[model samples]
Target chain A: MSTPKMNATGEKSPQTRAPLPSQVVKEDEPILVAAAKAGDISAFETLVSRYERKIFRLAQNITQNREDAEDVMQEAFLKAYEHLSGFQGNSRFYTWLVRIAVNQALMKLRKRRPNQVSIDEDVNTGNDLIPREIEDWGPSPEERYKQSELAGILNSTIADLDPPFRIVFQLRDIEELSTEETAEALGLSVPAVKSRLLRARLKLRQKLDRYFRRSENQ
Target chain B: MNCKTLVVELEDYLDEELDSELRTSIEVHLAKCKNCKLIVDTTKKTIQIFCNSEPAPLSEDTRHRLHDALVKKLGRPRA
Candidate 1:
């Protein structure tokens, strides 16, 4: 396998860049942030380019619609730009920016579905535990073949999750954000983030189990 | 640990959030219980697959449009 090349900053070169595992970049974001706060538009643009795709994907996952995601992306960057000075840098720039994007996405969702209940509200009080008979299917030939199809299945299953669970899964599992960061982004407690993440993962596993089992039968 | 007990602690176990003693106990149980082991292993694989999948990039047109709009609002400054 060809070794992945790195840029001068030791980040994966943009040309061959895969989805970033974490939002953190080692480059001098604080300098760019300072410049942007002082009206350096180019500085702000650099930051935008670095994170726009990530922000867009996060929006897409939450909204479950590309168009709304685009709108949210645009609104998020603009909102962040306008509020540059207010950014205290207490958190990573991407984290702060994500908070803005998530809010925009959630706002759009609310408008589109006015009767929609808050994700925190109306969660079933009962245990509603998942069935325990999860199949192993360890290292089968079908597992190798199923890799390609997994993406589609994963997307559909995730989309089927309730907004609260879906958002947590997107941020925590897909984006690989820390539980604390996920909680901060969604304005939930750390325990809440963990609970949602656990449920989301369990649900996805169940879905995958069923999908693989059916595929094997077929 | 029994299956019910294991089920309650499974997420934490997989996430390595449990205390070392609890983790050891769970591991010991997993070694003996094929069903519970399967659940843990599969759940781990499910998370791994999801995380490893490459996220689709934003369309080029969308990228340019977003950049241009931002540039228009916040005029381009010299690097």
Candidate 2:
């Protein structure tokens, strides 16, 4: 097999992807927000149209339950509507809405009666923390990428991340927000965001390493 | 920063959030510490792979339900 070319740093030459256009379409969310605040429903609808998907995804990521996510999404938008007049435009509308969604989702989690698992047990007994003989998790990152199953496995591994870490990773990773933006959205300090993101990525790597190791051994 | 400090700052370094002075310190350490370099590389690749996964699309029914609820609560504004 012809090996993929390595760059100056001895890493695969990174493929460039087009940047996502900024999500805020209208230069003036404040204007739309102002109209909505005045009970102009059209302006409110415009605001909703701009942010529904992002709000939905944020809720879903936090709740990890489709039904709960739907409820959180609805409640968040409704709350935003009720308090529309209160918005001072101190932050981007999307950022404010994200806070609302995240708050709603967390409240839902708390109300649901958390599962019986102990926090200490969950942390100490986490899959990666348990010591096991290192298995060669496949040929290496390069070789593993060639496998058809790797993608599916990787997807599942991300799902397996703890919710807090997963949200941070999703915001920083999938959303491509800068660390500062993510911290602001999630109500975390940049350092906290950095640590959570790193821990999340490390956990994911360990999980994939386990999968590849098993595959190689078979 | 030494390997120990660099290891702690691995995430900040990878995220490009480290201040230039601190970044310079870490880069100097990375040049000497192969282990720290590997950790950085692996962490970056892991994040890239995780984030690059296809986003899950929102369900149509969920979208409709949200729209309906928002309309009911706020009502459509006058033209």
Candidate 3:
């Protein structure tokens, strides 16, 4: 048998398929969340099966360490289960779960980087929002790379961003949190979330442009 | 709107939060400004790529440990 390959993100090569996750529960999340809150173990397991991969990725992106990421994901789920009764279903369960996970990931990140004072510094880059690269990447440029290569490009670029920008971007873009939700999750004002999101998007675009640019495609 | 202002409002434009008049102004600027247009398009693509990409699968061992830990910690929930 061929040994499993590893990538920059420490994900086992996509080829060494992990045992296919069991049927991802098709039920609406609120229903599952309700059941889990009611002590229905299988319902909670279904939620776990449905979200583990995304939660793991969110943690890995924030902590940038696989083991730390795993711990964060595990701890997040445990806490979510422990606090199930408090969840009022006011927002999406996933979003609420994401809030718990982000808090867990940030705690791990803060412990690892003691000198970094805060992830919500409200940076001001007056008149610095211009795009340096002016080239078009034709439609579906990501289709140009194989999945693993594309994943590598994304992971490495995001890992380079300072934690503040990276965390906002991860929640807003990758996880599809609303601007307000992202703000609430991180304890930042809505404006602060907007500011960081703009910088993060532009910076990520500049980084990804190297490989996806029209010139690079030629 | 000039490029700097356009850039500042880029997220709002992309997210379609701008009222129509402001949105049209940005759109007009995008039509006339190649650089701004590229920035908008590619920034959009960047979001789309990450948004659509599948999360990598968890290793089975990691999956098992997560489940085992939950069960142990939470105490298997009452049936």
Best by DockQ: 3
For model 2, which pairs clash?
Answer: A41-B77, A137-A213
Candidate 1's DockQ is 0.41
**Candidate 1 Cα lDDT to native:** 0.73
Worst 10 residues of 3 chain A by lDDT: A10-19
Candidate 3's error at A105, in angstroms?
0.8
Q: Lowest summed lDDT over 10 consecutive residues: which window, candidate 1 chain A?
A: A1-10
Residue pairs clashing in model 3 are: none
Evaluated on chain A only, model 1 obtains a TM-score of: 0.77
TM-score leaderboard ranking = 3, 1, 2
Residue-pair clashes, model 2: 2
The window of 10 residues in a row where model 2 chain B has the poorest summed lDDT is: B48-57
Model 1 reaches an interface RMSD of 7.4
iRMSD of all candidate structures:
7.4, 8.3, 10.8
* Per-candidate RMSD, Å: 6.6, 8.4, 9.3
Kindly report which residue stretches of model 1 are placed more than 4 angstroms away from their true locations once superposed: A1-24, A125-130, A139-149, A211-218, B77-79
Query: Judged by TM-score relative to the true structure, which candidate is superior, 2 or 3?
Result: 3
Summarize candidate 3's per-residue lDDT along B1-79 as a digit string, tens digits. Answer: 9898897787677666677899899999989988888888888888777766788899999988897898797688423
